[model samples]
Target: MHKRFLIIVIGLFLLFPLLGRAVDSNQQILQLRAQIEELQKKANEYRKIVATS
Candidate 1:
């Protein structure tokens, strides 16, 4: 019973950081910026290919 309680406590501690990050606005903004930049790069490449073809 003691081991099981310790395991549950450890699991909750490990999960807290992930829960915190899920609600973090700064991280969300950075992720959005990265995705937008990647998509823009892909669009530019596609435009160049279409122009040449």
Candidate 2:
């Protein structure tokens, strides 16, 4: 029983860091997507100006 508990505790210690990285990666992806959308909007506006000229 003690050995089983020790293994579970060690497994969790290893798993938590991976979980934290996954959360960070998700946030980074969201930020990148937002930036891409903003840049696309600017490109479309520029296209409109060029088309008019």
Candidate 3:
């Protein structure tokens, strides 16, 4: 039982960083998507101006 517990602890310790990195990567993806949307809006506005001129 002690050995099983130790193995579980070691496995969790190794997995913790991967889980944290997954969360961090998700946040980065969200930020990048927001930036892309903002840039797309600016591009549409520019297109409208060009069309008007």
Candidate 4:
């Protein structure tokens, strides 16, 4: 019974944070921006190739 209680308490401690919104890391934000830029460049290049052919 004591072990079960301890397990329940620990579960709540971890779950509490997930109940609130979280922050994104700077590295993650920068990576997303780079991905968007690369996709846009590829799209423009594809459009040019289609126009030529």
Candidate 5:
């Protein structure tokens, strides 16, 4: 039982960093998506101006 417990503890220690990295990447992706949406909105406004002119 002690050996199994030791193994699980080691596994969790190793896994924590990988989970943290995944969270970081997801945050980056979300930020980029927001930027893209903002750019698209700007482009749409420019299109309207061009059409009116």
Candidate 6:
């Protein structure tokens, strides 16, 4: 019983970092998507200005 508990603890310890990294990566992806959207908006504005001029 003690050995099983030890294995479970070790498994969790290793798995926690992977789970944390997955969360971090998801946040990074969201930030990148937001930046891309902002850049696209700026590009559209520029296109409008050029079209007017």
lDDT of each: 0.96, 1.00, 1.00, 0.87, 1.00, 1.00
lDDT winner between 2 and 4, please give it. 2
TM-score each candidate: 0.57, 0.87, 0.91, 0.51, 0.97, 0.85
Q: Model 2 RMSD to the real structure?
A: 1.0
Candidate 3 global TM-score: 0.91
Candidate 6: which pairs clash? Answer: none
Candidate 4: which pairs clash? none
| Per-residue lDDT of model 2, residues 1-53, tens digit only | 99999999999999999999999999999999999999999999999999999
In candidate 2, where is summed lDDT lowest over 10 consecutive residues? Answer: 1-10
Stretches of candidate 3 exceeding 4 Å from the true structure: none
Better of 1 and 3 by TM-score: 3
Q: Model 6: per-residue lDDT, tens digit, 1-53?
A: 99999999999999999999999999999999999999999999999999999
lDDT of 4 by residue, 1-53 (tens): 99999999999999877655344455678899999999999999999999999
Per residue, candidate 3 scores C-alpha lDDT tens digits across 1-53 of: 99999999999999999999999999999999999999999999999999999
4 or 5, greater by TM-score: 5
- Model 6 C-alpha RMSD vs. true structure (Å) is 1.1
**C-alpha lDDT (0 to 100) for residue 30 of candidate 4:** 85
- Of 2 and 6, the candidate ahead on TM-score is 2
TM-score of 5: 0.97
> Where does model 4 exceed 4 Å of error?
1-24
Candidate 6 error regions (>4 Å): none
